[model samples]
Target: MSDKAKLVLGDKTVELPVFTGSEGEKAIDITKLRAETGFVTLDSGYMNTGACTSAVTFLDGELGILKYRGHSIEELAEKSSFLETSYLVFYGKLPTASELKVFEEKIASYNDVPEGIKTMIKAFPKDAHPMAVLSSNMVSLSAYYHDLCAQDLTPAQKDEVIVQLMGQLKVVAAYAYRHSQGLEFIKSDGSLDYCSDFIYMMTGNKNVSKEVAKALDVLLILHVDHEQNCSTSSVRMVGSSKANIFATISAGVDALWGPLHGGANQAVLEMLEEIKNSGKDYKTFLAEVKDKNSSSRLMGFGHRVYKNFDPRAKIIKVACDSVLKTLGVKDPLLDIAKGLEEVALRDEYFVSRKLYPNVDFYSGIIYRALGIPTNMFTVMFAMGRLPGWLAQWKEMVEQSGFKICRPRQIFTGDTKNTYIEIKSRS
Candidate 1:
């Protein structure tokens, strides 16, 4: 190890003595960090830590670049299918022809979730959110497969666990959506491709055009994995505790259901509906977003990590235009979204912060076009992200020296407050 500490900022570098404290103590230890996993940054903002270099997605926040298993996201979205991308993320390579065929068959075969699971889903409250139903159902699956927890599961069985769970998430997602509305659940058609099948399952009528299905396919593919993202990180953190994949993934689904993370798409649509109900023009709404006094932010217009742009947003924008044109469906909210994107991209505050639209920006539009309810948006996200969580869980179990995640904090509360006598009231 180098004795000197090197600090590189932008193009400048400075060397200082390595930090070490007095006898039997330590000042700082840079050796513990996994620098190769991503470009190291010394920011006072937040410290994101994880394993050393690993095979998975790569995200460059400043450049707005995302790659999955060495393939550019744009390329994958345009040229690859969702199932193929998912296989790559999990297995670390694009599947061969036979492998791809077998994988597809495996997933399609498991499309039907157990009737007991469906029955349990119906017992949920009618007004329950789809994400909640989906998460609860996923945890319930643990009971059905409790035997796997104790047995020495084989590698092939592990693969089966991931593939089946990926397929079953779509079933659970669709069932939750239709169940909440008291609509009859739609069954999956084996002939239809993955995205088309998901759409068909929600909407009994299979009227989706080939072009629209293709766009939806790409959307699902692009969203399949984002390395070390909040929810994925949560999944790995929970999996580190030796939880089964189903339980760990359920935890991830619950985490993603939060408003600040995967639920942003649903929140964006709700915000748009609110803006429309306000009886204000798009320009007026844009003005409100700009007004610091209002403290109103344009939902889906910015991201926490992607400082320059959100790559998924770019792909979905193209799909949005295509789907709208192909379906000839026009909603006033689409126009508002376009206008907001234009205004936010050019504004100084957004420019300075490098804030741009994210995946949530166009996702709601696509869901609306597909006849999916706005409330089910995060369910769709959960469906797509399930594979990523499983892959991370498997990788963590197979490789990393995993342990239960219990972070420590320095306590600054009253150290020696005396307990008052209950009988001696003042």
Candidate 2:
């Protein structure tokens, strides 16, 4: 027996013997800590947890590599459409010619929400947040598809539900917006592409140029899946409790509502509005972000992972320029965003943190150009990530050895206290 820590990561087991320091104190080589445990913290003060070794996506932060279903993200952004990438992420492969066709047909078929659901949506106050309505509507979907909730459902039945959820999420999301605005529900056009149809459903118009649709598609692809992110983890945790898919995904939606997560895009717009209202130019806004006392943060900047930079942001930057240029839309905020990125990149704090503009940065500008309200941005995100969460939930159940997720908490309350009866006290 060695007096060292043992860790297990993935399938690897490693044991390290205790180290004796010169002062007779035990010590660990902070810089030499290797990943051995499935999920253990290293002496270097970084967490190492084996969430899952997913074959669905690979992210190499140092190398700036991101792949979905084994295809390079750059390739997908340029060549493959968003729906195709979505199919890749959910189904674990690029859809073939016939498969893509059938997949599009299946998605197109689910373009309209039921009238009852729309009616229910209309009952909510117009002032209610769109995300709240979306979350409620998503949970309500399970009640409508009560038959699909059977525990002993066949594989075919499960796949059908998955397809249904992916397709219907758009309708549910768009209807939430329309219902809030007192506008009539716009049905999806079977002829237009998936993202184009979704944009049409929300805008009540089919005038989305091909360029805008393509940009929106790339944006959707970028957000499709990020391995074990907060919202994704929320879905898995809820699913681990044996909750039905709809409920699990609804929980995920609630998690994504946080300002730091899917809500970041909304925050970005808010920050931009603040800067605009302040009468500050790009330089002044950049300085404010750098000042510690100012306590102002450049929204849409920085990320948790990808210490080098966010690959998705890079892709979106290109697409953002192209879409805005092609549409002849002039947004000064775009220039301000670019200036902020430039100043942050040259600064020390941002460089050390590997903070870069993430998917949230360009997303708001694109949504603005498309006539989608800022409040609806996260709803759109929820719609795009639905397939990813569903696929993860399915994979977690089918392939991965599932476990009930229950985390521990350190107790801090008083151990004991005396209580007196009310009558006795009186």
Tens digits of per-residue lDDT for model 1, 106-208: 9998887788998999999999888888888888888888765643467987898888887888899888878887898998998988888888888776876
For each candidate, give its TM-score against the true structure: 0.87, 0.86
Model 1 Cα RMSD, 1 decimal: 6.3
lDDT of 2: 0.78
Cα distance off (Å), candidate 2, residue 8: 14
Steric clash count of candidate 1: 1
Off by over 4 Å in 1: 1-53, 281-295
Best by lDDT: 1
Q: Alpha-carbon error at 373 in model 2, in Å?
A: 1.7
Question: Candidate 2's residue-wise lDDT over 101-176, tens digit each?
Answer: 9888887888776777888888999889988988887788888887877654578877787778878888888788
TM-score of 2: 0.86
lDDT of 2 at 33: 44
Model 2: colliding residue pairs? 7-36, 7-37, 8-36, 8-37, 8-38, 9-37, 9-38
